[model samples]
Target: MRKSIIAAAFASLAILPAAASGAEEPPHVDYSFAGVFGTFDPVQLQRGFQVYKEVCAACHSLKFVAFRNLGDAGGPHFTEAEVKALAAGYDVAAIDNETGEATTRKGLPSDHIPAPFPNEIAAKAANNGSAPPDLSLMAKAREGNASYIHAILTGYDHPVPEGVQVPEGGNYNPYFPGGVIAMPKPLSDGQVEYADASVPRTVDQYAKDVSAFLMWTAEPKMEVRKRVGFGAILFLGALSVLLYLSYRRVWRNVDH
Candidate 1:
């Protein structure tokens, strides 16, 4: 009789409402932009820049970037003159040697935008205990790197089935720690239009572009590395062919 009562109690508990059960699942979003793994698109990079400037800049700091670097091969592909013109809109600070003060100067190739918070202490204080990580090396620092970012961006989802138990304010993400994250999805399809028609205005397109730009920022010499690697392979292939020909010639006279 006791076992029967206990089973009935458990079955009743299982049928409780989601709120009563304190159950909610993390949001699931489709993060596969373009395909499983896609290279960076310059057209999308420009649109991402627009999104960052208009939305993300309010809370985040891209401290490592100079306005001029936007014209790099993997960047927005801004022209030299266009970059110069764009850089002119922002002011950068320099140490004034004569007065022992940091003075503001128009942004130049040498200057990086000062961080929003003076230091980590101030940054954490400003962000409700969540430190806005310096995105300078994010693409390189994280494992599975670009794919991880793409997944996280689109992982928002609705609650799980009723009666399921999920922690408060915790959303489900297979990639994030504990399947929960404090940050919400930041990109949406058509949220920001691309100035260049070559790039599609999709969430995946934006994610790929920004991720690529971040990767380039992390390793500016990547293109050069690719070129060097290709050249070496070609040289080695030619050398192998020459050696094979020489070996054949040397043995031609002796072999039956």
Candidate 2:
């Protein structure tokens, strides 16, 4: 009995790697905000926000983001008037000062993005027992970050491989863990009409745009941070050279 149990344990352990290996790696994407000197393209970020609002908003939320962030430097960079106008369109929960009661009011720039459902239970009930995750920190939270998100969004185009049994109501996406995802194909060709006539209105473009937007949402200060880091590196490099020269000058007359 002891030998049999040990053998079973080993067999289970062996199966784990095989199951994990079944999922495909997310394909690489050359995003604008990559590498040390990378900076976000304002237009791309704007288009990405549009995709999130029109398509993903129905299911996911950006609870950590605020309307005012749209006007901030290094992001979508919408004007102050545009940000205020956008904020006014959304209804947010607020306290009625006179009555001291909870009430809904027009959103302000300070108000956080709202969830589609009131609570987790409601969200799960609406989405086939799978609550749609908030997209606020999704880029930072996931392993492959933006690439993973882009892959999942576009992965639906591939045909299901043989011997795969997708669960009920779940779509087959090889990039998704377990090869099944609850969310259906959210984008289609020409689904959204872009304001820019040059940009292609297609699923691939939408995926790329939204992925970039999420990355911005996740690390809004990334540009500032990079700039500071580079400045520090430069300062240190210059200091090192100065110190080396000083040491050489001071020790020049001394014997080793």
Candidate 3:
């Protein structure tokens, strides 16, 4: 009986890892690279802008990006005049003379973008005791950018087995910083429509586009880096070919 019990215990241990692996969730998504153009898709950027303006802007903030930057790489719908006008809409930071305190004055080239809330405490108080995280560096901050966005937007799925609960007026998402979050999934199928027929109006499509845009917001100069690398590679390849031909000519008189 003792030997039989020991054998049973060993069998259970052998199956444990496989069982755990089967129960584990899928891996996160990544969105660090660009598609075929070696640059961002203007259409996707425009769509992402629309989603940000319509859905995300009210809660989250894009403190890192300037309106003027939108005109780069042929961003759709926003012109230079419009970007300048848009950037000028808000008050930027300045020094307050009466109290000798640095405060926001109006929108300017020098000012850091303002936060939605004065502080984390204020943000949580406003949002049912849940703080809305700053999104300025979200793309860079998190791993697997695309997966992060997709999981976030679709985070409203069934609860985890760990007895995690989403309290009243709060939201739940598996991919959030904390497994339990207060912000609900903001997108759904056909929640918003797009004028561009090539771009689908589904929530997944919106999430992808917006995620791509945020990635760009995090690294606007990536295109330049990619272009430089490609150019260097081509130049090196040509040099290598020329060197090979020169070596053949020089060695011709050396005899085999």
Candidate 4:
């Protein structure tokens, strides 16, 4: 009996590697905002916001972001009026002062983005027992960040490989862990009309744009932080040069 149990354990351990092998590494993308000097593209960020509002918002939420962030420097840079107008369209939770009862009011630029569902339980109930993750920090939280998102979004194009069995309500995506994902293919060609006529209206573009936008949401102040770091580097470099000159001058007459 003990031998049989040990054999069963070994067999399970052997299966683990095979299961893990199903998920493929996401392809690298040369995003504009990739390196130390990276900067977010305002136009792309705007388009991504549109995609999020029209499609992803139905299932996922950007609960950490606010309407005012749309107008912040180094972001989408939507005008103040536009931000206010957009905020007014959404109803946010509030409490009535007179009645002391829970209610809702039009969203304000200051308010955090509201979730599609009131809570996790409702979100799960609406999405086949699997709650769609909040996309606010998804870019930062995931292993490959934006690239992983792009891969998962476009990975649905291929048919399931042989010997793979996708469970009910689960979709096969080699980019997704365990070779299955709860969410179906969300983006399709020409699904959302782009205001910019130059950009292609395709799934790949949509995925890329949204991925960049999510990255911005994850690190809204990334540009500012980068700028500060660069400035500090310059200051330190100047200080080092000055100190070296002073040391040479001070030790010139008393050389060791």
The sequence of per-residue lDDT tens digits that candidate 2 reaches over residues 1-256 is 9999999999989887647656777889999999999999989999999999999999999999999998898999999998999899899988999999999999898888778889889989999999999999999987789998999999997888899898888999988888899999999999988999899998999999999999999999999999999999999999999999999999999998
* Model 4 agreement with the true structure over 21-135: per-residue lDDT tens digits: 6678788988989899999999999999999999999999998999999999899999999999999999998999999999999999998878899899999999889999999
* lDDT (C-alpha) at residue 229 in model 4: 99
Worst 10 residues of 1 by lDDT: 27-36
lDDT of 3 by residue, 62-145 (tens): 877766667777333367676666557767767898998988665653344456776778778888887777676687776565
Worst 10 residues of 3 by lDDT: 20-29
- In Å, residue 235's CA in model 4 sits off its true spot by 1.7
Clashing pairs in 1: 26-171, 26-172, 27-156, 27-157, 28-157
User: What digit string (tens of lDDT, one per residue) describes model 1 on residues 104-205?
Assistant: 777775566456677788877766666677766777786556666666665565444455454654455555654556554677888776667776777776
TM-scores, all candidates, are 0.70, 0.90, 0.70, 0.88
lDDT of each model, Cα atoms only?
Answer: 0.65, 0.92, 0.70, 0.92
> Which sections of candidate 2 miss by over 4 Å?
1-21
lDDT of 1 at 111: 60
lDDT, residue 42, candidate 2: 87
Q: Indicate which candidate wins on TM-score.
A: 2
Question: Considering lDDT, which of the candidate structures 3 and 4 is the better prediction for this target?
Answer: 4
